[model samples]
Target: MKILLLSFILLGLYGFCLGAGGGGVSSSTSSGGGSMKETEDTKRLREGRPLILTCEQNATNLETKWTKDGNELVAGDHIQLFPNTTLYISTAQKEDKGEYSCKTGSMTEPKIFHVVELTLQKHLPKSTTVLENDKLSLSCQVQGDPELTVQWLKDGEPVEDTDNSTRLEMSDNEYDVPNAVLSIKPIQKSDSGNYVCLISLYSINVNTTTVVRVKDIYAALWPFLGIVAEVVILCLIIFIYEKRRIKANFDDSDSDPAQDVKNNVDGKKENDIRQRKH
Candidate 1:
């Protein structure tokens, strides 16, 4: 009976210890689950733009520390830190993308840690000029997260690549950014407008605009017309100068005739004096 009672007590203690161990694991998992959710946050920003990461904890006057890629971040020419839990990047570069963390806490409370995966989206602005009845091509390339959807818009309406005059070429492979080319064969004057390359991923959307200017066929003739006008003016000036020179020669010839007649009368008087002497 004593041995049986001892066995029951031992079994009871073992179950109690197991229960205590299970409860501790459950409590640990609950706390870690919340931290995992917080750490899984991510943010995407456009390159060459400002990025501001702020902590929204209810605790005020908490000391905050910011770090990027396991290194502490400090204020610099392009980076700024606020008294509040805010990290400001004046201009985001490719090197600025990485894991960022913000820790905020007071002396009495536990520190709250937040982890964000920072990513930068890239786009290049373009400007194109095509002459009338000439081929036009504009390339719109972007880099970002996968599942990128691209749309080309002229003015405000969506561009139709199926049109006989327009063609759009896209990359066959899947990419985080779209590699698209918009082409218009024999582009017309009416096609001159803003062409926008819009990219969307989930709820985020970004666009880059290309200003397309169509030149008229007669645009090249403008310099030719200016040259023709200049030639006409030069010919007019030469013609007027030649006419004035001819008129001056005619006036000098008319004065020469009077001088010739005066010389002829003087010769006759000299001949008469010679004959009287003989």
Candidate 2:
């Protein structure tokens, strides 16, 4: 009886080992299948155009279901999901501007993708309006997660082979450094117009316009006019004073001449009479 019991116990232990081995194999197969699918997806994405992706949850299946700009994408949309689960946009256009989400299955939470909007702005250092003959500087600033290439435009034309009357200097704030200065020495009137900054990033282009008006030299002529007015007022005061003095002298002369002659003759006659009597 003891031998029979021992045999049964040994058989039960062997069956347990076999069951454990089977479970390990099943798990390995499942993991391998998932990894292969991811690799294939990455390869397909590389061969396709770039696409913007959005997800509702983190654990969603990035392989099977993908959405662009919050809209469900068709199979032929030419978008591929990578192992790292990043969505690529082959050619981004104005219509492509929106949100994206990625998901695995209906039960998984959706992961929302952050959409970065690229903007190109034409910025002047500090003062937008500068006096003529003063040093002026303008910078083309591009804001986006990915780096953008900037191009300067003047009067709706590309600025190339331009003269030094409106000199342009280019700098960057790529590493989050503030104050990207574009120095222009001696800004000119011709440089005044709508200045534009064009930025291109990964099939996306944006432009910003700034109206630059260089103050003319004649703007300060008012002060000179003020000085001239002061001088004119002083001349008028001097003329009025001289005219009054002349009138007073004439009035005194008209009365005094006749009286003086009469008084002199009477005094002389009196003196002669007195001398004779003595």
Candidate 3:
């Protein structure tokens, strides 16, 4: 009877331990699963900013390791690991982008904690100019995810395609990068203002603004007129200088004609003296 009683006690303890162990595993898995969804919706990271990621498991004394594309991450100057399973990057760069996974002790598969992707937007001129009745094109290039949306705005209002004269064109290229161009054929002076390119993807929205100035057709003529005036003024100055130089030469010659005669008589007298001495 005592042996049967001891067997029953052993079975009961085994069952209790199994239940506790299963419960703890379930709780940790639940916490990690919740964070996986949150990480999916994370906003795009900007360059030159700190990037931090934390493991969300709720278990005590858990061993967590971070990896990128299956390579184990080592703590260094730019990368740091905290005791709480958190990773810190001092400054985010393009090369530091990839799939980052967090794994716990003896896990068959790592949970993707975050995917680091950088949005690279090309720069536009701060101020652009267009002549009246001339064609102008402004291109906005964005590279990253394919689902990016681009929109153009003018002075806080949406730009419209009017009669096909002013329209936007998207490029279909081999590399599949998103590119948008705003074109105005035969642009008018009324088209001058602040133009903005707004790019959006998921939870991230970024924009760049450019000021456009339109000049009149006659506005180009002013520079030509100024050049002609300069040439005319230079010719007048040369003419005045040449006329004064000739007048001064004529005056000097006429003022000393009598001195010229006296000089000729002195030269003959010296020549006769020299011949007599010889």
Candidate 4:
């Protein structure tokens, strides 16, 4: 009876220990699963470049599985989990832009994530307009994380002149300062044409054209001279009218004196004749 009681006690103790161990393992798995679900996802990519995807986890030993648009990625696409947990595509095309997800074996569901969309865009400079004979300065602007290089072109030909007359200046900004200043001293009429500025970066080129019209200085001067001539003619007309009026007044005064003298003589003769008749 004593031996049987000892055996029963040992069996009961073993059962309790096994149950406690299983419960501890279940709790640990549940906590690990919760942590995987709460993992944060971040994605970023440059415009017109390849896309990069990343996965992260709070736990150190967690395994990560990557999928794209509900399809399982092959061994080539599987990215190992790290602190940063990033994957790179050599050249991200438009077709590769989509949603992605990551999951661990300890998690119940996959964590929804996204891949940065790589879009190729062409950026040109602002269109500038200036009066003829004045300095023409223009700059091309492009916004991106990485700075861009700028180039200048005139009428489909690259401007080879770098002697401050037609040169491109570089800067570390997306929009470069007036890198190119076209100085045309005493602009001639022949300078009027399509002035084009071409900006190139990473095999992508953008062009902007401005129609420059070298206004004929004579075109503006002729009208001004015409206005001045009209004013001078008007002043002469006013002076001539005043002079003619003054001359007419003087002539009328002289004629009045002669008429008065003749009238007096006639009256005296009439009186003498009347007296003789009487």
Candidate 5:
């Protein structure tokens, strides 16, 4: 019975130790988190601004590593690892755009960052009406850090001007950064449509539209100005006819009046002669 009791005690102790060991292993396994896929997160940041990307963990102690796309990141003066888990970009630039992630044990979903330096908009001469045969000049302005690849479009198609092209001329002027000018020399009615100034930088595309309404030089005359001209010509003809008629009346009427005056004068003279002879 003593031997049996001792054997029973040993068996119980072994079972208890085994249970404790299994519990310890389970705890350790849970402490290391499994990799999880996340939805895409995208960010648009202004160039030259600071940004932070973080990787939070459920574990108390974690060793974190950073990667961009799939390459292990090498921290530089412009980029640094903060708190050993968070990424700090000193100044976001166009070259900084990439998919970035941090790995505690497994990579978190990548955060996409895109940096834009400029925003372009129509600057001068609001939607305008220009007379036909007049030169059309348009300006497009940009704000923020402007790095631009510019193209001018008429209606909906790209505008390409050659040396021999008579109607369109394009030039870029850089007062501070630069603005584009489209010169439509002697703009025609066909030139009337939406003129868009397209500016693109990196992955950002911006455009400004200016509607041009080309007016015929005689557009205002529509129906009224022509009518006025016809009335003037008719009035001039009537005035000339009336003046000629008055002149004819003067010549005919003056002959009768003159003859009557002369006859009266002759009769008076005859009377005087007769009196003297008597």
Candidate 6:
């Protein structure tokens, strides 16, 4: 009778332990959320990265459930729930930014997962019309990680910015977002193409394109017109010099004709007198 009572007591204790929630929290393991280089109780991931969260419990008949921000996690294209109590996130997004918890018949500490949001926000013009030699300004509004870099491209190729000209500027706005500007003092016809603002961070790149339509009036004929004006000025100077030289020669010739005739008559008279004397 004592043995039977002891068996009942032990069975009751086992049932009581099962009714209460204690074994699952202690036996469950939180692992597999980062890369091989990093492992921690919680994970900090950037957007588009992949991660896995595994759970292990001591209960045999228990089923594991995953929750995000106190809401039940659903299996979707980007999220997969495995039978081995694993939750996989294929491509992390900003929406996935919250605390993640594994529920195995008990509520436990949630692992905070930080997802770094990446974005390229810009106000781009489809087509801009400006007169030739006018100032051109192309701006892009960008909001993302500060580590993100900005690049300028023209006509599907990279722009050469080796000079680091003052035409390009990067400033922070009120919210500390990057505001990039590419300004040209005298907009040329060559600058009238598709200008691209490329923003990149990690392996993701986003760009916006704009076209500049420059109205150049007689642009090709300008050099020829300048050459014609120079030639015309040179010819005018030469013509004036030639006319002054001809006038001077004509004035010198007019004073000589009458004097030469008188001198010739006097010389002949003098010659006849000398001949008579001889």
List lDDT for all candidates, in order: 0.59, 0.52, 0.63, 0.48, 0.61, 0.60
Q: Rank the candidates by lDDT, best first.
A: 3, 5, 6, 1, 2, 4
Model 3, 1-278: lDDT tens digits are 34654555565555545433321111111110001112343434558988877665444556679897679998999899876667789798766766688877757876675444535345556767666777767766555543567677778787764333344444532335455577776677778788787766554566766777777766655555555555566567668888999999988877677888899999999999999999
lDDT of 4 by residue, 157-219 (tens): 545552233323333333332333344444444554555655433333445555545443334
Q: Least accurate stretch of 10 residues (summed lDDT) in model 5? A: 24-33
Which sequence of candidate numbers ranks them by TM-score, best first? Answer: 3, 1, 5, 4, 2, 6
Task: Give one digit per residue, the lDDT tens place, for model 1 in 1-278.
Answer: 34654555565555545433321111111110001111223456558878777764354565677778778888899888777777788888767766677776643442333222222233434456666777666555544543456777877777774343344444422233444566677677788777777666544555767677777766655555555555566667668888999999988877677879999999999999999999
lDDT of 2 by residue, 1-278 (tens): 34654554465555545433322111111110001121111121222245444333254334645576567865445454554455656765545544455666553676544344454332333225656777666555546544446676766676654564246666666544233444565777777765666655554555555566676655555444544554556556667877888999988777777789999999999999999999
lDDT of 4 at 252: 78
**lDDT winner:** 3
The lDDT, on a scale of 0 to 1, for candidate 3 is: 0.63
lDDT of 5 by residue, 54-92 (tens): 676333455667777678887789888765466788788
Model 1: lDDT to the true structure: 0.59
At residue 6, what lDDT does model 2 achieve? 52
Error of 5 at 148 (Å): 1.7
The numbered model that scores best in TM-score is 3
The TM-score of candidate 4 is 0.44
Q: In model 5, state the lDDT of residue 260.
A: 94
**What is the Cα-based lDDT of residue 261 in candidate 5?**
87
Give the true-structure RMSD of model 1: 33.5
Model 2 residue runs over 4 Å out of place are 1-128, 139-142, 173-180, 241-278
